[model samples]
Target chain A: MTTPPLAETILSFLKKINPHQPLPTAEQNLFELALLSSSDFITLIQLLEEESGILLDFTQIDPAALASMQGLLAAFSAAETGSKL
Target chain B: MDHYPWLSPPDHTAQALRMDHHLWHYGQLMTHAELLSRAIDWSIAGPLRLLAILGNQDPWVYPAMLAAHRLGGGFLPLHPAFPSERLQHMLHQCQTRLLLVTSDGLATLDQLLPNLSDSMLCIITEDTKGNRPLLFPQHRFLDSTDLQQLPARPAHPAPNTQAAYVMFTSGSTGRAKGVAVSFANLHAYVRYWQTHHPIGPGDRVAQPADITFDLSIHPIFVSWASGALLCPIPPATRFAPARFILEQQLTVWVSVPSVAMMMERLNILRPALFPTIRLSLFCGEPLPTRTAEAWRQSTPQGRLLNLYGPTEATVAISAFEWQAESAQQEPPGNVPIGWTFPEQQAALLQEDGSLLLSAGTGDLCLAGSQVTGGYLADPDKSAAHYFYHPDSGATLWYRTGDWVQRREDGCLLFLNRVDQQIKRHGYRIELHEIEHVLRARVGHDWVAVIPWPGGTQPVRALVACVAAEENSPTADWLQHCRQHLPSYMVPSRIMVVPQLPLNHNGKINRAALQQLVQATLFPTEAT
Candidate 1:
């Protein structure tokens, strides 16, 4: 089985959480738009972990890295790569 | 009345509070309070009027509160995270001309200066460094360093009848209502706590709620009056409250039940995590039985109490002690809101102006020292909720608007709010205000905002059902709501329906709307 792209998975999750709002692009800042709060960010991490089977080190992850779609993709990709090793 | 009861003797050496790396002794806290009081007296003229304190939890909050009382003024604490518009509304509502803020709060005020009235003056506690020029040119800013340099003067005695603090809660009409509590009310609360759950000098009380919240008043005043050390939990530690309790070695823990729910969600609520906690009090929102059980398991040695009261009734007016033997007897997943304090009286009244004596449910009416006279500068709104007791001639009772059932044991079980208000994440929100904003945005009066898991289930999210014109876009309506309301007030989901279902009474049937929302969200369950 092939893994889906990190951005695709995240966008799918975002769409699931907010079905009414317009789909956010990868470059859009999720935090500034009030689409996600700190607790929501924590939920996002949990969802990502469940989907990818990669346990994230919550203490090591910077909250700023999850503020934007592009940032979240990068953080997830890095975590997935670290888990594979 | 020469000095407050919290102040230690001049020669005594004991820690009064611990924040981060800072530890303030009781003697030192008194001297600092005196210094701040003298500075305020010299800088401001006449009676202190309304003083606003805006910042995060810090040792300065105690001194600022003490100084405001000493100057015969009411202190209003503003949440630094609140939008500038909400802050401005509160500042104007209470007519706060004097502000005591930290450096961060100064930055927030700087952004809101244009919206603020010109009569406001700010006395900041931290040095601005080179950020002095960032402040509004018309307003004066003084630092704590300057306050320390000023000559000390004798503190003035504040009358017990004077207002102590003003806290703003969400109003159903889309405006924040300021509830001004007097010093006498606070004294009554303090006396009640002293008689029931007394805290001594050795107790280390945990401050979990933000300063802007009424729940925070419990730890602040209770600790001060008892000379107990106050341990403020940082924002990060709140996510893992049980761990924070263990690390801080807190003896008395007071917080909203939502914190316990969060602990349960994180799976961190294990038995014996809080062996040192002697008292665990939960209030603000209804305490779920599961959350209470988890908390009790963690702090088996501590006495668990579920307190219930609105902001209008001071911090809390009634308390129900949770016990393991009576756990099965409580409502499925809720703790009972027990007897009222000695200084307060509670009565349940039905819709037809009849009292619910024994084993009947009705709207809860509270009258006592804790209940506020009314909202500040809003006599109409105050009169709407407050009325003369039918039997007790001339006694004013504030209708809680909360439906509660009186059990055979005399304990009250919270049914639900009589109005459209709901508690989500421990913050009180008015469903009508959301519907009102949506109706205005959608250009239609037929809109119903319902909380999913509707009746009795803790509200997780708001779902707005609107009857819009054919092909009317919901995204635009959501954008408009986002612009006007706070993030918490915004509906999580928007369902555009052709028409809202109404019951035989010609009212928007909330039960139908709630079912529609649930069915739409979970199509599988509906079938």
Candidate 2:
């Protein structure tokens, strides 16, 4: 199962939040970031990817993306523009 | 000389460990270890230095461990994924004398270095054998480079009494406790392979468990001794292992049941799809019969066993062989932990705390050569869990805190835990560990964490219930969890209830809370 990079990152993020239910399309962000710590929410995901065994492709996840749908879409848009998710 | 098969691979030229989509022979494996041991010798002075290997599933991690033992001291394999603070606590608790870090792991170690006052030697290594370049450049650390010569001699194995490896597990007091396994305990576990399971050369055993997890030890020792290949499935790819399995033609499979369940969710565990799998072993959590059935169906020719043990008891002590014909006969709920290994002794602890030799349901306690010595630097904690029972003869018994029932057939059925420790995703978590971090915020102690959709289903995430008043902002409580706990320990969802329901005993009733969380989040789950 080769998931597109964006979908894989989104899937991992979704797993952390709603692990049981598969929800929210890529464009649709039912995000709840009230709990994201400053350390985890970074602009670039290089540091997280470096840590081995992590499932999420940090590039697909914008540290600020989960704050709201706009942030999520903007992050995806940035990723589409070739920014690391 | 004790013939510890694991310490010496039979064929130096045989394919040894496979990782990062590359095959590394035993020659390269031993050379890497020799280079690491030589590096340790140059940096550290003592013979009994405790070496903490800090890295992910990077190629050099295992060699680092071998290097630690080569120096005549013990090794503590740490997961770089853990928060730096937790790593620092472990390093400090051991008063570590030697540390080995893969170049990629240096970033996390960098955060911990300043706080550690103990002047120790740090060796920076890469998958030099795998030809991966150093992720970072520096003169401050020693790197594993071109490695050629074989170890001088498999010098008689280290004294059985000396520490072999120390595994730090989740703690309720907000600090992880290190369970130190002696050379004797590890050897006993490896010896289990000789009489039972009888695996040897040509077996391509799967390596999914992190080095931090004791489950990983089975492949490391068993494969090395038998000249079987230790095929490592990298972390990011572990979730989607079907491709890797078929590609590697992995003959032996091992993992926590959670990983199999995830594979089932992905819909790839089809019938007779993996004929190459000759053996499958699942541990670290309850193995649902449905999951086992699907797994067995996927590998029709493979034999499956559910093994059970605590970290205090090295790796696994008991195993239950699963058969397709006996599906109807298998005990309800999870597969029974079955009988203890031949060399091991198992006794049940009644509610009165008295030990029972047989035929009763209570706490599971193990006593044998496989039981580990007490935790490092924590005598009080050790005393509380490990004890010499009047009936245990000479072996010290370690209380597993697992509630188990001895069936009429003498096989043991795992029911649940006696305490707050719950195994989720093959990772042991102390519920109190999460509660400990949230206690300061909710002074009235109106906080409780319950597994979601709390029924027969495997726990997906933790749902924490907090008093509405204390958790007004909501994000603060979650952010607090995110800041303090590891990602696994953090509660995925926060429920701001007006007040928590209480039991007749007046203590916060976790049982009722579990039901409440189930009812609230999953109303249709059939409470």
Candidate 3:
């Protein structure tokens, strides 16, 4: 259930948008839980790009996995590593 | 059932719907509607009873709508994601007789059950997942199995003048009001799309909008009227819909322009990526030139259209096609709303409270069959917006608040709003409505809601400014807003200021306040 810090950044950013929401579990699928919508997922990607200083390739990401915080965090770490390599 | 192709499908074998791995033909869809309609007719005795479909976006939605009309009742779509309080007001406002639930809507129905009035909430669903008993002597569940056992009963087609559906839009009075669109009104609008456009049996249309949104009306009617396939894209796939669109080989695409903005953000809008798309219909918000151009490239064989209208006018009344380029006449950047449909009449309401028939810029007004009869049961609101124009020989005209400019060539350009109403993320919102709810909670009149980076551009946030308040009740205000207003209407930020900017006439200076809010959002750009 544990994800990288980038997931923490997304959770914090989501909190800013919907202030009333409680933090979701690391294994929880934000989309199914209705905590975050698909539109919000795209917005989170833009915010993550701004914070990470990398242009992530969304074509390489698995949409189903990206629905969870841990999966999103893992994708971010992979994108960061890919950019450096 | 007369003009609708779904009644007796054009080709019973032709595919009519694609949802959740099931591809149902026109006959199959009609059977579902027939069976469901008989079940409804048996349980609820009476014609013209309103049926409210409460659920997430799903395939069963269209069938439920058909079932309602099949029994001569009206269909009302309610998004379960909205706060329970707002949904209660809508249900009570229309005196909903039956509640139709989809598989995805179970949790939402559970939350809404306790708060409902003492009267029975007649529910129709497929899967109950039963464990706890429902309220006795009041509530009842009618599942698919029950519907299958019911004997066949003929559907009573309502009169054309009767309402086909009633759509609820944001109300500045703090509760939403319903715009009752009759069968005649719906047919008048849908007939235009069917006759004028080339869409036919082979086309597969992607309805990317939620049922609650009026934009979704286009695909459901336009496709079914011509025997085309209707694909109600799931909510999870909407923002990132490239794969689904490509996989379905969708031929027609309909959605808000902001969705393309989302696709643009995700870098999914590449040229020629959606070659199968033959028609691109954009409405519910202004279409940016950049988004339109990218979409035009994506659909190499398609036509890109920009349309404009309020929910009161039955979807859209005007459209501009991208391929018909008179480069000299078109304005820069923002796409024009083009011309009103030939079947309707358009006039301008000038600044001095007079009608302008031919030229000049002013608030837009529409008249004809497409104009709604009136808001449900509220003659006062009906009087405020809908009226007969004395100069036009008593023709009923619906006042559209959009500021528009018309040229000698009959092309229309969207200027701006004539009021504080704004479109945030393709959702029509009245800023005054947000302020109205907050004023009651905060117990003050100083709070003003402003769309950040304002003036027709995409709104990033709704910022509330309170004068002379030392502490910002940001968290509490958000909690209160979540319970009262829809998410899009909720203010993302609350700023405590010394005093709100004011004009010399003692009015809140909106332009000055917009500058202040924008400055706060982007501090480095502030002077």
Candidate 4:
């Protein structure tokens, strides 16, 4: 699947926080992101929630989006489009 | 009738007491209590106004316990081996009018007497006929002859919130914090434990922890509250754990991981030795997976429970039941402290002042009735850690410096301390994640990931390991890690150390390890 525009923005924000991780693929899940202990996840979530005005619940959000770099970007795109899916 | 009602109440007679032998027998205990009641009455009325219980070895402390309870005087329990200063501080703090000691502890107490106030009385447990300045009357274990002469006193209710005992806690701050646990809290704890772990009349609880440590309160008071047998082990014999448990037929083990590890290392527990143990309780420090695995292999009949709490919160605030099947699969990185007991709540909060409720990870905080009011003397430090939740109203939550994540499954997994979070260059780092990842790869099951101060560069990861040289290849370990972790997360240098310095409780002494690293970096030059 093509990287979603929302995913691109989220990935950019995450990369800004963690220079070591330059690019993120949508397949990366919550466990992987947590393993990296990246600074961007929380900051990006807040930024997206503020921009979209839809207060995202990171705690209950789909584990797949936070699973890998690819998955996180995809989730960000979905959030931007106003669908939790 | 005994003169002191609260001190020597008739209701505290042999009928109310319960003692059990491991072989499911009970005659000797009843007979002994009857005899000891009289002996304590006689001794107290006669020359022996004071008594000292060595506490560690004397299997039957019931009579001594009753004797102190009946006499309307306080029972001052001390670790027979405590350094003079610590012991003196405790004795002074407790305002102990009299001190009871066994023959063995006499020498230690005697050496400390000059430093002690002259008003104190010293009573020995074993018979020593002497008119020496420090010498006093000795009392024997309960025998049939003693019970006959004891006068029965009227019963009165025990004050629930009165100071039952003062136990010293080692605080991160320099001064030791004395947790003055109330009788009400003790009673509540005992009632709570008794309800959970049903103890009938004949059950034997192995009291292994030193009296100085609060965990020992479980075996001491729980036995009394539930009418179970309290079996004390010799302090020295604690080193030889296997023999002690086997001979004592210890039904419950209440101790820290350090003592438990000693038993595991010494091969003290075999399949045959522990059929009676219903519960093996571990607390005070973290239990390494290796030690937990060893215990599981030895005891299949009993349940192993890990209890976690600061002394500030009475003995244990949270507990996790260790299952052999589940543990073998995940093999705990840092065992989650489970959840708060009955009425307690555990929460996490983010740096932005938002509460990270429901599976969110941040600074782990505890709120409940079990949370103590504050530190004994220091209000500034106390105010910093304890805060009231205006949203919750009236109730306060203690800001435990521990950082943790509430897992999706609702288990609270402990991360490192909040202070452990350090920024290397612009990157925030948690050293524990690196340590956990390193152990997952290497043959060295033991590893500590520490950041070395690097001038004008990102802090260097100084990895210390105890990997075996014969079979495990270092390249394979690095390659295995490369597949899972990013290059930045990996340690800059992985060095093999002969042994890691461990604290008294067997945890890798992080402060000492950092000091060792600093020493290596700046070695002393000989003149």
Instruction: Using lDDT, give the best candidate's number.
Output: 3
By DockQ, the better pick of 1 and 2 is: 1
lDDT per residue (tens digit) for residues A1-85 in model 4: 3244555666665554333433545464533343333222344555655555554433234332454655555565565576674
Using all chains and alpha carbons, the TM-scores for the candidates as numbered come to: 0.86, 0.82, 0.90, 0.57
Model 1 pairs in collision = none
Runs of candidate 4 with Cα error greater than 4 angstroms are A1-85, B1-56, B59-76, B96-98, B123-129, B132-155, B172-174, B266-273, B328-331, B349-357, B377-387, B418-527
Listed models, DockQ each: 0.20, 0.06, 0.32, 0.01
Question: Pairs clashing in candidate 3?
Answer: none
The digit string of per-residue lDDT tens for model 1 on B1-527 reads 34653353323477787887889887777777777665563334323266788887567877778777766666889877677878888887776567788755766777777777655667778854246446466677677777877887666666877788888888878787888888888888888998899888888998886788788888888887887888887754554455456667899998878777755654567788778998999987888888888888888888999998898888999999987765676656788889889979888888789766678899999999888888888999999888886678877799998999888888888988888889876677888778777888777788888886776766666888888666678778878887667676788778878889999999998888888888887454321
Q: Give the Cα error of residue B489 in candidate 4, in Å.
A: 34
TM-score of chain B of 2: 0.91
Give the alpha carbon lDDT tens digit for every residue of B2-106 in model 4: 332122111343223222332212333333333343433323322222233444444344445445544333244666655565566655545554555555566
* Candidate 2 Cα errors over 4 Å, as ranges: A1-85, B1-10, B41-48, B126-140, B144-156, B441-444, B455-457, B524-527
- Most accurate candidate by TM-score: 3
TM-score of chain B of 1: 0.91
Scored against the true structure, residue A17 in model 3 reaches a CA lDDT of: 56
Q: RMSDs, each prediction?
A: 4.2, 7.9, 3.5, 21.4
Alpha-carbon lDDT, every model: 0.75, 0.71, 0.77, 0.54
* Error in Å for residue B511 of model 2: 2.2
Stretches of candidate 3 above 4 Å error?
Answer: A1-25, A28-43, A50-65, A77-85, B1-10, B41-48, B127-136, B324-329, B468-471, B524-527
The true-versus-predicted C-alpha distance at residue B2 of model 4, in Å, is: 11
